[model samples]
Target: MKQAVVGYKVQNLLNFLVENPQLKDEVIGISEPLAATQTEFVMRRRRSLQDEDAITVYLLGMEGTVAPLPLVSQVLQWQAENIKAFVHSHFPGDADLCGIIGRASQCLPPLRKALNATQVDKDEVLSLFIDHIDALESAKVPYPSYYSELLEMVLEDGFTSEVLHSKLFQDAAISIKEWGSPRQQQTFVAICSICPTATARMLLRYCSYDDLSPYVFDYFDQRSVGSMIEPHTYLTIRRRLEKSLSRISSEINVVFITDSSNGAVAANASGAADATFFSVRPFNKPVTLDTLFVLDAATISSFHQLRGGGVSYPLLCAEARECNSRRAASNEKRKTLPQGAVV
Candidate 1:
């Protein structure tokens, strides 16, 4: 008898939510379930259902007030297929509710399985995955694994610039960066490399110093110097890097350069007369650029002296010369090689 009562109550609540559209919206939007009961729509519903039964009366009270996540979870439990159908029927042309339902029902594997088994459209599935990705955090799903897996799944059919700029993709990238998994890092690079122009545009708009720095480094690492060898690609990447470096803190003078061996380097300049060099490289390869280096405030002063045929900063000047000479030697070596010979 107790099992039957509980089951009836669950069904009653589900029916109530379905029948009362405004009340359902309020319930989903409300952060606290109890808060939703105070809303005008829910209060009106309570008055109408006042004399229905003990179960109906209790549900119309705080008993029926369920937070969005738990409510969707309950709904999913009662009828897995109904969740999607419920969205289409009750919340027609409503993106907000779609996102809410998607997010709330995401942690239920059975629902996802049912959706897949029934051959749901790929676009709908992608939207569902994006919405529910955060649900994993609360569900204690293995985050990094799921993150990469979902990314690969979404990109299986290829993605557009629009997809890259979506809140879902951008947020996922930020989360991946925070996780700092090497495998995921490479995945990030590969995704960005597919459409370098779009990636650059997105970085310029959405990415901060922390995000852009690592992406730039990782991109070169994965794609190697050969990928950006095109004049347009090189300029696009260079301009973006310059923008990022320019926005860094004034106190920390960083010199961005590509070495003779095609390695990208960022050296932090200290207060000393000669800027202390440090190597921060994404990969080791033959990275070359016409304008090979960006000297910050500290090194720029000495760089000016070197340009005027004076060697006020011997260390920095010598290093610059060494880099140029090595590059020239590499070019000359290539020239001496027979046609089609690998250097």
Candidate 2:
């Protein structure tokens, strides 16, 4: 609910880790495979959703499309009707959306590791919703339309608090408003709280959630959330992460965490099988090694160049400058002096 679904904390470490030159390549090595795999996965998914002919047509329409991240980030935010809303706001014709999707197809890999490690409170929250709905039903006096309407709407379309606010609620509200186990708004809020999980389910309904859901069942359900990373890619990614952590001899500490839906990760200043890193397991079990790779990917974040306002260490800069100047002078003198002449 709080974006634990995105592994917000894992992202913080990854952001910092990518900064060091020594570790950057390895970081890419670990993450790139996963990203590449995601790209293929997205492509295959799009093909399934639309068609290859449609995809080709879209590609033909685009001549020069700018980066997709700006557009894709915008796309990712809409709670419902994302593509529909995005097309209206961002594109004039098919070209831009095609281009953006093309770009997104490639780019959504970087942030995925965090998503793979995602843990959500959906089931817990779902249980809470059930309890409230049950309470509301228990206190209600038998009415022909009230329970039928709620149950029909909840089961048919899915649970949403909108039903309580809609015209459908007019009769029910009038009759049930006085019962007050929970006010209509409170009961509705509890129902709507499952929206995030439902949204996640809708997003991942098709693909790899089947194998991975058991690993992180609470965060994932029948609807879908995160899928398992490709096995080879996932294993390679773990190795690369470990490699980067090993090579970078800095004060920075990295804790690799993986979370399953109901899983609990044990960590606390632990190391990489030693005393440097905290091995995180997000599920209740200790199947950190056996479970699917929990590293989720997302749209890639580009490695940034140094910012303009950075202040140099003046003393160190001056010292290095002087040393370089002295070496240059000595080199020039040696060049000027005759070969084998001692002065």
Candidate 3:
């Protein structure tokens, strides 16, 4: 009965090859001797042996052909352990592996477990993971969450792939929550920081001042050589730090500057007093509009000197206007006088 069943299967296979002339030509083109191969098309199984054997035979017959594209999805539908050997053995080329790796989310759970159990196909699978990391980073995969297990595998192997590090940096920049757990975030940071410049710049670009300030300081103190950073990156970080400090200062302290004699209030960017000019006195409480008066010449001159060319004249009262008039007259007289004459 078993011999008749084997003969029947062989006859059906011959009939299939005859019906498909292209597949027949491919089978004839096989250069490698199938008899010398270590793994057989059949394996010992407890049940459904016929079904398993059929899948193996079908996969082997379709080897070295364009049919693996559609065949891969079918093989992926089966148990990973059941079909992984055929996948690694028959579809060992780059194109085939890439196609399978692109659907990593669909097959990674079981196939990853199977691959992790054996050292034989680990390198090939890891290479695919490193090469096509972008595919894993895309929307198809849920990013760090889905790949956390794979990350553990890579970490265990003591291997670093630059692109994987870049992806982790990008994911962390988007949201630290993308790493799922606090432990994962810490782990990712440890790995991602290997590419320090790229990781630091990405965090600087996307993270809030409160979120990234400590990292920047830590990078400078611990990681940066001689505390040196790129000019643009350094300036950007400094500006953010200054702005953050200014916000905190404004919240904690309130100082209103007013002219001692006329009580003219000077408007500054922040409520904190300008310690540079000593003519005005700072009050803790808000000054009423009734106490408002125009700024004097000394105060205007002091404010302009401190603020540079773009000083606003909102507080310029009658006294300031007259001072401007005198300054204009002096400029006109100087233009009319001889080159060496003093105004």
lDDT of 2 by residue, 1-343 (tens): 2112222333333433423334544455554443343334333323332222210100000000111111112112332222233333333244533343334324344322322335633334233333433453355233223323333322223223221111111111222222222322111100001123333222222111121111111221111211222223223322433443343332222212122212112211112211011111111112222222332211111101001111111221232233334434544654697764321
Specify the highest-TM-score model's number: 2
* Candidate topping lDDT: 1
Off by over 4 Å in 3: 1-107, 110-114, 138-142, 145-343
User: Least lDDT summed over 10 consecutive residues: which range in candidate 3?
Assistant: 55-64
Give lDDT tens digits, candidate 3, residues 1-343. 3322322333233334434535544643331222111011111111212332211100000100111111222222221222233334334454544444545735556545544554536556654555445454343323443243333332222113221111111112232232213332121111112122322333232222224322322222113321112233233323433354453332211111122322212223221221211121111122232232222112211122222322111121122333334445545664797764422
lDDT ranking, high to low: 1, 3, 2
**Which is superior by TM-score, 1 or 2?**
2
Note the residue pairs that clash in candidate 3: none
Taking the tens digit of each residue's C-alpha lDDT, what string does model 1 give over 184-238? 3211221222222222323323332234334323232113222322334343443
RMSD of 2: 29.3
Comparing candidate 2 with candidate 3, which one achieves the higher lDDT? 3
Local distance difference test values of all predictions, in order: 0.29, 0.25, 0.27
- After superposition, the stretches of candidate 1 with alpha carbons farther than 4 Å from their true spots are 1-226, 231-234, 245-343
TM-score winner, 2 or 3? 2
Instruction: Give residue 200's error in model 2 in angstroms.
Output: 13
Q: Best to worst by TM-score, what's the order?
A: 2, 1, 3
